[model samples]
Target: MLADRIPIADALHGKALELVHEHRAASVPLLERHLSIGPDMAEALLLRIARETTVVRRVQSGLYVYTHGPIGEELAALHGFAQEVLVALASNSVDVDQLRDAAGRYGFSIPHQAAGNATVAVPLCLAQVVNV
Candidate 1:
């Protein structure tokens, strides 16, 4: 089931990055248990995963932590965008003028405020309609 949700390459590599960020350093058995990976494949997967992500540092003789540089920066930027949009939307219904104001304040031009409104509104409407 877990395999179906995420691509194998991402699951192996991305999950390792996530684990290192969360646990700092982990052993083979621990990683296997946490990720539900077989012992036979654990070492190879760990090595492959570690090769892709940034190594923060070695915490122990045989343990290391990993993180992604581009992904981290992208997530931070996305969080900032979401926060600004939510704050603006929370104060009042989002309209073209308000989104334009927000875009200016955020140092960018969202010239397609109407298009963005439709994009956001469709999901909101769907959530209400589906009771999600």
Candidate 2:
């Protein structure tokens, strides 16, 4: 998982976010395996985390995909930027438009249809962190 290499938040919510971000799309079993969390724990985590994510309504049953949402208020700008970029690029390998779309998180849409909502500027700028 990509997130396994990236920094993770000490909180369960943060950890869960990283997991989904890494995998792009994830199932309950995937979360449980990576986090060593039980089904109940995964469910609880999903309930809260889903708000900041985009789940394919009719695709994978438990597939949870992350998007920078309100619940993500606790995450750092750098990390959140990574998550948003990953989610945008999940469906399509290299989509620069996805990064610019929505500004990166508004809410749920028909799966990949959502490219809205930005990471809500806090401090860290995506360009500043990336080197050309």
Candidate 3:
């Protein structure tokens, strides 16, 4: 049932949520470190999660940024697996360090720069979400 029930979007979103919890914010380096993925892959995942959840925030230059609020909550819930993780992190309102620790438990290795950055760059996969 688990195999049959798992959706690609759900899995991807879960991964993104885990990275967000670990980084306390979404950034390329954090996502790459946590997921063991490249910056491109991490961006793709973020974009996918954002699109699937219908959570659109303004992009500064090329990076996507979101605050802890209703939109964030809704986006987290869209992925199911990410909902709890996001909620737990958001509730305490911890900083990037705390977020990195949380991600470490899940085997994420974030970068210092990524943790420090506020902007998260999204990948092309997000096009689907934007188009919809």
Q: Largest TM-score belongs to which candidate?
A: 3
TM-score of each: 0.35, 0.36, 0.40
How much lDDT does candidate 2 score? 0.52
lDDT of each: 0.51, 0.52, 0.51
Better of 1 and 3 by TM-score: 3
Query: Total backbone clashes of model 2?
Result: 7
Off by over 4 Å in 3: 1-10, 54-58, 70-132
Model 2 TM-score, 2 decimals:
0.36
**Candidate 2 wrongly placed segments (more than 4 Å):** 1-10, 52-132
Highest-scoring model, lDDT: 2
Compared with the true structure, the alpha-carbon lDDT of candidate 1 equals 0.51
Model 1 weakest lDDT span, ten residues long: 118-127
Compute the lDDT of residue 46 as modeled in candidate 1: 60
Q: Extract clashing residue pairs from model 3.
A: 22-99, 22-100, 22-103, 33-109, 34-108
